[model samples]
Target: MLKPSTLNNKLRVLLIEDDTIEVMKLKRAIAKLEMPHEIVEAKNGEEALDILRNRDSLPDLILLDLNMPRINGLEFLKILKNDEVMRFLPVVILTTSSNRKDMLECYKEGVAGYILKPLKYDDYVEKISTTLNYWSSNELIKG
Candidate 1:
Protein backbone atom coordinates (compact mmCIF):
# COMPACT_ATOMS: atom_id res chain seq x y z
CA MET A 1 0.00 0.00 0.00
CA LEU A 2 1.10 3.55 -0.75
CA LYS A 3 1.70 5.95 2.06
CA PRO A 4 -0.73 8.85 2.43
CA SER A 5 0.53 12.34 1.74
CA THR A 6 1.10 14.87 4.50
CA LEU A 7 -1.77 17.05 3.33
CA ASN A 8 -4.18 14.12 3.13
CA ASN A 9 -6.27 15.97 0.60
CA LYS A 10 -8.08 14.58 -2.41
CA LEU A 11 -6.99 15.56 -5.87
CA ARG A 12 -9.19 16.08 -8.88
CA VAL A 13 -7.23 14.56 -11.76
CA LEU A 14 -7.90 15.00 -15.46
CA LEU A 15 -6.84 11.85 -17.28
CA ILE A 16 -6.68 12.30 -21.05
CA GLU A 17 -6.18 9.05 -22.94
CA ASP A 18 -7.56 7.33 -26.04
CA ASP A 19 -6.94 3.76 -24.89
CA THR A 20 -9.79 2.13 -23.02
CA ILE A 21 -7.52 -0.43 -21.40
CA GLU A 22 -5.19 2.23 -20.14
CA VAL A 23 -8.09 4.06 -18.57
CA MET A 24 -9.40 0.91 -16.94
CA LYS A 25 -5.92 0.04 -15.64
CA LEU A 26 -5.56 3.42 -13.99
CA LYS A 27 -9.00 3.22 -12.42
CA ARG A 28 -8.27 -0.25 -11.17
CA ALA A 29 -4.96 0.83 -9.70
CA ILE A 30 -6.58 3.73 -7.92
CA ALA A 31 -9.24 1.41 -6.54
CA LYS A 32 -6.70 -1.15 -5.39
CA LEU A 33 -4.67 1.55 -3.70
CA GLU A 34 -7.77 2.97 -2.07
CA MET A 35 -6.95 6.51 -3.11
CA PRO A 36 -9.56 9.17 -2.53
CA HIS A 37 -8.60 11.19 -5.61
CA GLU A 38 -11.33 11.93 -8.15
CA ILE A 39 -10.52 11.05 -11.73
CA VAL A 40 -12.13 12.84 -14.67
CA GLU A 41 -11.61 11.02 -17.93
CA ALA A 42 -11.38 12.34 -21.48
CA LYS A 43 -11.05 10.12 -24.54
CA ASN A 44 -8.96 12.56 -26.53
CA GLY A 45 -7.57 16.05 -26.69
CA GLU A 46 -10.73 17.57 -28.11
CA GLU A 47 -12.87 16.12 -25.38
CA ALA A 48 -10.33 17.20 -22.77
CA LEU A 49 -10.39 20.73 -24.08
CA ASP A 50 -14.17 20.77 -23.96
CA ILE A 51 -14.09 19.63 -20.36
CA LEU A 52 -11.50 22.23 -19.41
CA ARG A 53 -13.48 24.96 -21.12
CA ASN A 54 -16.84 24.14 -19.60
CA ARG A 55 -16.05 22.80 -16.15
CA ASP A 56 -16.59 25.05 -13.16
CA SER A 57 -13.78 23.40 -11.21
CA LEU A 58 -10.64 22.59 -13.14
CA PRO A 59 -8.52 19.57 -12.31
CA ASP A 60 -5.44 19.79 -10.11
CA LEU A 61 -3.39 17.51 -12.32
CA ILE A 62 -3.59 16.31 -15.92
CA LEU A 63 -2.24 12.90 -16.99
CA LEU A 64 -1.84 13.10 -20.77
CA ASP A 65 -1.04 10.52 -23.40
CA LEU A 66 1.07 11.55 -26.39
CA ASN A 67 -0.68 9.67 -29.17
CA MET A 68 -4.42 10.16 -29.69
CA PRO A 69 -7.04 10.29 -32.47
CA ARG A 70 -7.51 14.04 -32.87
CA ILE A 71 -5.23 16.80 -31.65
CA ASN A 72 -2.43 14.64 -30.29
CA GLY A 73 -0.78 15.15 -26.91
CA LEU A 74 1.79 17.63 -28.17
CA GLU A 75 -0.88 19.69 -29.85
CA PHE A 76 -3.00 19.57 -26.74
CA LEU A 77 -0.02 20.60 -24.66
CA LYS A 78 0.57 23.59 -26.87
CA ILE A 79 -3.03 24.63 -26.60
CA LEU A 80 -3.08 24.16 -22.85
CA LYS A 81 0.19 26.03 -22.39
CA ASN A 82 -1.13 28.93 -24.42
CA ASP A 83 -4.18 29.31 -22.26
CA GLU A 84 -3.34 31.85 -19.55
CA VAL A 85 -5.50 30.22 -16.90
CA MET A 86 -4.84 26.60 -17.80
CA ARG A 87 -1.13 27.02 -18.31
CA PHE A 88 -0.51 26.93 -14.61
CA LEU A 89 -2.23 23.58 -14.17
CA PRO A 90 0.36 20.82 -13.70
CA VAL A 91 0.32 18.33 -16.59
CA VAL A 92 2.25 15.07 -16.38
CA ILE A 93 2.89 12.97 -19.47
CA LEU A 94 1.77 9.43 -18.64
CA THR A 95 2.42 7.69 -21.93
CA THR A 96 3.88 4.57 -23.47
CA SER A 97 6.15 6.60 -25.70
CA SER A 98 9.80 6.36 -24.67
CA ASN A 99 11.11 8.44 -27.55
CA ARG A 100 13.64 10.97 -26.37
CA LYS A 101 12.29 13.53 -28.84
CA ASP A 102 8.81 13.17 -27.43
CA MET A 103 10.12 13.37 -23.88
CA LEU A 104 12.15 16.47 -24.58
CA GLU A 105 9.29 18.14 -26.39
CA CYS A 106 6.87 17.44 -23.57
CA TYR A 107 9.33 18.99 -21.13
CA LYS A 108 9.75 21.94 -23.44
CA GLU A 109 6.00 22.27 -23.58
CA GLY A 110 6.02 22.43 -19.77
CA VAL A 111 4.83 19.06 -18.53
CA ALA A 112 5.38 18.48 -14.84
CA GLY A 113 6.67 14.93 -15.35
CA TYR A 114 7.10 12.40 -18.14
CA ILE A 115 6.48 8.75 -17.34
CA LEU A 116 6.50 5.72 -19.57
CA LYS A 117 3.76 3.19 -18.96
CA PRO A 118 4.99 -0.19 -17.85
CA LEU A 119 3.86 -3.39 -19.55
CA LYS A 120 3.35 -5.26 -16.28
CA TYR A 121 0.17 -4.56 -14.34
CA ASP A 122 1.93 -4.50 -10.97
CA ASP A 123 4.60 -2.15 -12.26
CA TYR A 124 1.98 0.09 -13.74
CA VAL A 125 0.17 0.27 -10.46
CA GLU A 126 3.36 1.06 -8.60
CA LYS A 127 4.29 3.85 -11.00
CA ILE A 128 0.85 5.41 -10.81
CA SER A 129 0.83 5.12 -7.04
CA THR A 130 4.26 6.71 -6.71
CA THR A 131 3.37 9.52 -9.07
CA LEU A 132 0.17 10.30 -7.24
CA ASN A 133 1.88 10.15 -3.89
CA TYR A 134 4.59 12.60 -5.00
CA TRP A 135 2.10 15.02 -6.52
CA SER A 136 -0.21 14.82 -3.55
CA SER A 137 2.62 15.93 -1.30
CA ASN A 138 3.29 19.05 -3.32
CA GLU A 139 1.50 22.34 -2.89
CA LEU A 140 -0.53 22.22 -6.07
CA ILE A 141 -2.25 25.35 -7.21
CA LYS A 142 -6.02 25.15 -7.40
CA GLY A 143 -7.24 26.49 -10.73
Candidate 2:
Protein backbone atom coordinates (compact mmCIF):
# COMPACT_ATOMS: atom_id res chain seq x y z
CA MET A 1 0.00 0.00 0.00
CA LEU A 2 1.11 3.55 -0.76
CA LYS A 3 1.32 6.21 1.92
CA PRO A 4 -0.34 9.61 1.54
CA SER A 5 1.90 12.39 0.24
CA THR A 6 3.21 14.27 3.25
CA LEU A 7 4.95 16.84 1.05
CA ASN A 8 1.59 17.58 -0.63
CA ASN A 9 3.28 16.80 -3.94
CA LYS A 10 3.04 13.26 -5.22
CA LEU A 11 4.54 12.02 -8.47
CA ARG A 12 3.66 9.28 -10.92
CA VAL A 13 6.90 7.64 -12.06
CA LEU A 14 7.23 5.31 -14.98
CA LEU A 15 10.12 2.91 -14.28
CA ILE A 16 11.45 1.30 -17.45
CA GLU A 17 13.71 -1.53 -16.30
CA ASP A 18 14.19 -5.10 -17.46
CA ASP A 19 15.65 -6.61 -14.31
CA THR A 20 13.12 -7.81 -11.79
CA ILE A 21 15.57 -7.38 -8.92
CA GLU A 22 16.21 -3.78 -9.88
CA VAL A 23 12.49 -3.11 -9.98
CA MET A 24 11.98 -4.60 -6.53
CA LYS A 25 14.92 -2.62 -5.19
CA LEU A 26 13.39 0.65 -6.35
CA LYS A 27 10.05 -0.19 -4.74
CA ARG A 28 11.74 -1.11 -1.51
CA ALA A 29 13.72 2.11 -1.54
CA ILE A 30 10.58 4.18 -2.03
CA ALA A 31 8.84 2.37 0.79
CA LYS A 32 11.81 2.81 3.08
CA LEU A 33 12.01 6.50 2.26
CA GLU A 34 8.29 6.86 3.04
CA MET A 35 7.61 8.54 -0.27
CA PRO A 36 4.03 8.55 -1.51
CA HIS A 37 4.75 8.63 -5.22
CA GLU A 38 3.07 6.16 -7.56
CA ILE A 39 5.27 3.73 -9.55
CA VAL A 40 4.27 2.31 -12.90
CA GLU A 41 6.62 -0.47 -13.98
CA ALA A 42 7.57 -1.70 -17.43
CA LYS A 43 9.88 -4.67 -18.02
CA ASN A 44 11.52 -3.07 -21.04
CA GLY A 45 11.45 -0.16 -23.39
CA GLU A 46 8.88 -1.76 -25.70
CA GLU A 47 6.48 -2.35 -22.84
CA ALA A 48 7.05 1.16 -21.57
CA LEU A 49 6.25 2.59 -24.95
CA ASP A 50 3.04 0.59 -25.13
CA ILE A 51 1.97 1.82 -21.73
CA LEU A 52 2.75 5.40 -22.66
CA ARG A 53 0.85 5.19 -25.92
CA ASN A 54 -2.25 3.70 -24.29
CA ARG A 55 -2.44 5.53 -21.02
CA ASP A 56 -5.13 8.16 -20.44
CA SER A 57 -2.94 10.21 -18.12
CA LEU A 58 0.80 10.15 -18.66
CA PRO A 59 3.31 9.71 -15.86
CA ASP A 60 5.09 12.76 -14.45
CA LEU A 61 8.58 11.33 -14.94
CA ILE A 62 10.34 8.40 -16.55
CA LEU A 63 13.19 6.46 -14.87
CA LEU A 64 14.79 4.64 -17.76
CA ASP A 65 17.35 1.80 -17.93
CA LEU A 66 19.86 1.73 -20.76
CA ASN A 67 20.29 -2.00 -21.34
CA MET A 68 17.35 -4.22 -22.24
CA PRO A 69 16.08 -6.69 -24.80
CA ARG A 70 14.16 -5.56 -27.90
CA ILE A 71 14.37 -1.77 -28.16
CA ASN A 72 17.19 -0.46 -25.97
CA GLY A 73 16.97 2.70 -23.88
CA LEU A 74 18.74 4.87 -26.45
CA GLU A 75 16.46 3.68 -29.22
CA PHE A 76 13.41 4.24 -27.07
CA LEU A 77 14.66 7.67 -26.14
CA LYS A 78 15.02 8.57 -29.79
CA ILE A 79 11.50 7.49 -30.55
CA LEU A 80 10.11 9.32 -27.53
CA LYS A 81 11.99 12.52 -28.35
CA ASN A 82 10.53 12.44 -31.85
CA ASP A 83 7.00 12.28 -30.53
CA GLU A 84 5.20 15.61 -30.32
CA VAL A 85 3.48 15.04 -27.00
CA MET A 86 5.87 12.72 -25.18
CA ARG A 87 8.96 14.75 -26.06
CA PHE A 88 8.28 17.17 -23.25
CA LEU A 89 8.13 14.40 -20.64
CA PRO A 90 11.17 14.34 -18.36
CA VAL A 91 13.28 11.19 -18.77
CA VAL A 92 15.95 10.39 -16.22
CA ILE A 93 18.39 7.61 -17.07
CA LEU A 94 18.98 5.23 -14.18
CA THR A 95 21.45 2.58 -15.22
CA THR A 96 24.75 0.93 -14.31
CA SER A 97 26.40 2.13 -17.49
CA SER A 98 28.86 4.94 -16.84
CA ASN A 99 30.11 5.11 -20.41
CA ARG A 100 30.86 8.69 -21.40
CA LYS A 101 29.54 8.10 -24.88
CA ASP A 102 26.25 6.78 -23.59
CA MET A 103 25.95 9.69 -21.20
CA LEU A 104 26.66 12.20 -23.93
CA GLU A 105 24.13 10.61 -26.25
CA CYS A 106 21.48 10.65 -23.56
CA TYR A 107 22.19 14.32 -22.87
CA LYS A 108 22.11 15.05 -26.58
CA GLU A 109 18.72 13.39 -26.68
CA GLY A 110 17.59 15.70 -23.85
CA VAL A 111 17.34 13.48 -20.80
CA ALA A 112 16.43 15.28 -17.60
CA GLY A 113 19.17 13.45 -15.64
CA TYR A 114 21.52 10.46 -15.66
CA ILE A 115 22.09 8.43 -12.52
CA LEU A 116 24.36 5.45 -12.00
CA LYS A 117 22.99 2.65 -9.87
CA PRO A 118 25.11 2.63 -6.76
CA LEU A 119 26.69 -0.56 -5.44
CA LYS A 120 25.52 -0.03 -1.90
CA TYR A 121 21.85 -0.40 -1.15
CA ASP A 122 21.90 2.64 1.09
CA ASP A 123 23.49 4.71 -1.64
CA TYR A 124 20.87 3.54 -4.11
CA VAL A 125 18.10 4.50 -1.74
CA GLU A 126 19.66 7.90 -1.16
CA LYS A 127 19.97 8.58 -4.88
CA ILE A 128 16.38 7.52 -5.48
CA SER A 129 15.10 9.65 -2.63
CA THR A 130 16.99 12.70 -3.82
CA THR A 131 15.91 12.25 -7.43
CA LEU A 132 12.27 11.79 -6.52
CA ASN A 133 12.33 14.74 -4.16
CA TYR A 134 13.75 17.00 -6.83
CA TRP A 135 11.20 16.01 -9.45
CA SER A 136 8.32 16.24 -7.01
CA SER A 137 9.21 19.86 -6.36
CA ASN A 138 9.46 20.74 -10.03
CA GLU A 139 6.46 22.10 -11.92
CA LEU A 140 5.73 19.26 -14.33
CA ILE A 141 3.44 19.58 -17.32
CA LYS A 142 0.36 17.48 -16.83
CA GLY A 143 -0.62 15.79 -20.05
RMSD of 1: 1.6
Residue range 1-143, candidate 1, lDDT tens digits: 57565565688999999999899999999999888899999999999999999657899899999999989999999999999899999999999899999999999999999999999999999999999887776766432
Any residue pairs clashing in model 2, and if so which?
none
| lDDT of candidate 2 at residue 13, scale 0 to 100 | 93
Can you give the lDDT of residue 49 in candidate 1?
97
Model 1 scores a TM of 0.94
Off-target runs (Cα >4 Å) in candidate 1 are 141-143
List model 2 lDDT by residue over 28-128, tens digit each.
99989888889999998889989999657689999999999999999999999999999999999999999999999999999999999999999999899
